[model samples]
Target: MDHDWMYKASYTSEIYAAGVQSFLSAAEANRVKKRSRSICCPCSVCQTFQYFEDITEIEAHLFENGFMPRYDCWSRHGESLAAFSTSSTANDTTYNDDASSLNSTYNNDSSNLDENDNHLNGPDDNLNEMLHDMETNMGDAEIENLQHLFEDAEKPLYTGSRLNKLDAVLNLSNLKSKNKWSDKSFTKLLVFLHDRMLLEDNELPISTYRAKKLMCPMGLEVERIHACPNNCILYRKRYENEHKCVVCGASRYKQKKDSDEVDDDEGPKQPGNNIDVYLSPLIDDLKTLWDLGVNLYDAYGKEHFQLHATIFCTINDFPAYDNLSGYTTKGKKACPVCENETSATRDVFSTIIFDIMVHLISHIVQEIKACGPVFLRYMYPFERYMSVLEGYVRNRHRPEGGIIEGYTSEEVIEFWQGYVKGLDSVGIPKTRHSGRLDGHARVGFKTFSPSHEDLHDAHFVVLKHMTCLAPYANEHMQMLRLTHPGKDDM
Candidate 1:
């Protein structure tokens, strides 16, 4: 009963071993009462979700990985509240009797139950709940694909094979990606396996395209929402069927194409101030989350609960802040907090520039007071992410599509990486100097002697960029020009 050994003692310690032994005995008793061979393993790795029939395997897992943190209750292993309290005997008896009756009824009518209902009592309760939640959002084709994937997951790659159909396909896809295999090469390999190796009857895909299609259900679904050609608004909700832009009055489709698809090359490069229109979907989702909340499974708790959230504050650069906050970030009255009280200064030309950015600096303290901290609301992370998105844009003419495709591929690769362990990573592999300090290379080093000209050039470059030497360098240059009139300054 003293669960302190879980955290205080090492897995190999006598206290921990005794604790695991006691836990297994109780769990085994519970398993026998439920007429089940397997009991949920409460080890950190298994987390009470994965079931194990062999008691020795469960014990080994606990010894190797230790029990899941904060599992003192043992609720899943049949240690109920009634066992701790004698006062609840009458209420516990009544509840148990009703539960037994319900269980008997369900068992008697098992044949009439739906496929989803059958999984309700199975170990894959999380998967069933997730699929049920996705049903409302996914199309018929996506749902069918997901169901097929689920079915394939249970079937082994071959007789007595440890890997399932899903695992085999995922592992193969990961290998192809990591090795940078060409489509033709992958197809040939698949052909060799299926034809020559005699694995054609198994669930192995014969082509790279087929394999990708099979793995489609595992990737996140992308919704292609249409937006106004003029970047005024998205053609959704109220403008779901509108032919022309409500604000700009421009036709949604290209005149030459005579179709609903707008030419990507012809549209505005960026949404500019109309970004709010593009963020309508995100805003709606946030509003729903704040109001009604969403049902999400808590892995640690082993139950579903309503998750509610709201944006604390927006983090963006000045230009983006102007568009999202609907405040002018330039000219006079640019400071939203100061507004009319913004201070102005005249330049050397006696012109009042009214630089909003300079004036806004004075009110940074007030902004920080309202928004918690400057670092919390800074655009450093967003700017770094923008660089990553820029790298994804292979096709400059259709940067949006390029980024979406690249990002989706990365997401799928990442998903596969989670399932197919021990494979080489999918993206650009990290260099040896990844976590090293700037200018420090971890690779084998070589000494180099710079020539006189090279050394001079390097010193000149370093001195030219040094802020402390700037005034002196400028003064020396002025002296040189004054001392040698009509001569080249260099």
Candidate 2:
């Protein structure tokens, strides 16, 4: 609020702008001859300094790490600074008192001081009160009278305590904790770990690696990978002693399930430390995604391009669109384009399409390993998992568009030609289909001769509008007797 701080902010902002223009010019020159000058940095501040290397790096760090909105961000930072300045501000308490006494008609102490002031100050909740008190009373300006209360309301039952109470609550004496041997839940666990060989540090944190060799169409980056890529997702055999293990995917959580707990008639009990296991939700997530992948293939191969959004429509209570089947074309209720329920449904799939893939794969490994006895087939371990995946596709991962390729125009054409056509029409060699493009069916959008750039834009449009499905992915995987993220460190 002071002129000094205001002047500094303006100077900093201008510096940010000047830096971005430099980066943009450089990036534009680097683009392919036919490609658009679309040098996307995603970080708005970085976008501003598209040309300056040093300033752009600074902007990138700020955006990637503490990328909060301006006012909230500024207010939070100010609150932190005020916290550190408490003693100094107290030194100003006398100054405030002297200033207030000058206006003897005003009683400031009676204004800002209140019962809740004894407790923690609510962030947004105190804004209106602070303004009212500042206008009415003079005591609010006193540093001693205006002590800051750090509220950690974001954490449930978090009352400014460093020690976690949940751990104690979980460690009670007489609780008939789950016996992992239940036919419902086997002691099996899934261990999925992927550590890219790249070293990382605070400077270049979460070293991103492209899985170029991973047979995936849409390449992904490993944020914190170390040499080993674990789980079914990494697509390599687990190197440890996988045989004598119950195969639980827990890494560092103390899961309950004694080896001897299972009955003699049921099966042989595997042995281990049993508590600390390693599993990421991404594994089982892949299994569920594979099912959707199968369905997509089935639908598209047979020219069943009715579209995933069409299949999702059969689910009751889902939102529908005007001109869409089951909804009247005229007099139908609709909001703005983004607010439309149809887009919401599509987005549920589009955004989560890949996350679903990750979660499905993660779940599949955990389900078979953790719930070994209950698991029947080697392929489709849990029957409910298929329905879970379908429900997720319909209810959760729904995207405005049904694909998750993060596509560009060129990529879109390649998808249609290499994937859509190869699977449904022309043949691709030596892969899941084995020496020829696997499966059969008429596919629309194949050989449809669209410009390369248009295809990319369409794919990006689909991805940009995509949404993720976390509820179901977290649900089934946890239900399968595997440890959840909050339950473990890894």
Flag regions of model 2 displaced more than 4 Å.
1-14, 32-34, 41-490
Q: How do the residues 231-271 of candidate 1 rate in per-residue lDDT, one tens digit apiece?
A: 88888888889999989898888677667886567744677
Question: RMSDs, each prediction?
Answer: 13.7, 30.1
Candidate 1 lowest-lDDT run of ten:
88-97
Report backbone clashes per prediction: 0, 75
lDDT of each: 0.65, 0.29
Error of 2 at 112 (Å): 64
Best-performing candidate as measured by lDDT: 1
Model 2 agreement with the true structure over 1-490: per-residue lDDT tens digits: 2212222333246443343333233333332221221222324343121322222343354434322222111222122323433433332211112322322312222332332221221222332222222222222233222222111111112323221222111111001121112211211110011123212210111111111111122323333321121222221246343322233343422247767575454322322222112233344445555455323222112222222221221221112222123443222122222234433443444544533223224345555667564225343434444453332122133331112222221132333233211122111223554423534544442546779999999987876555564566557667654545456533
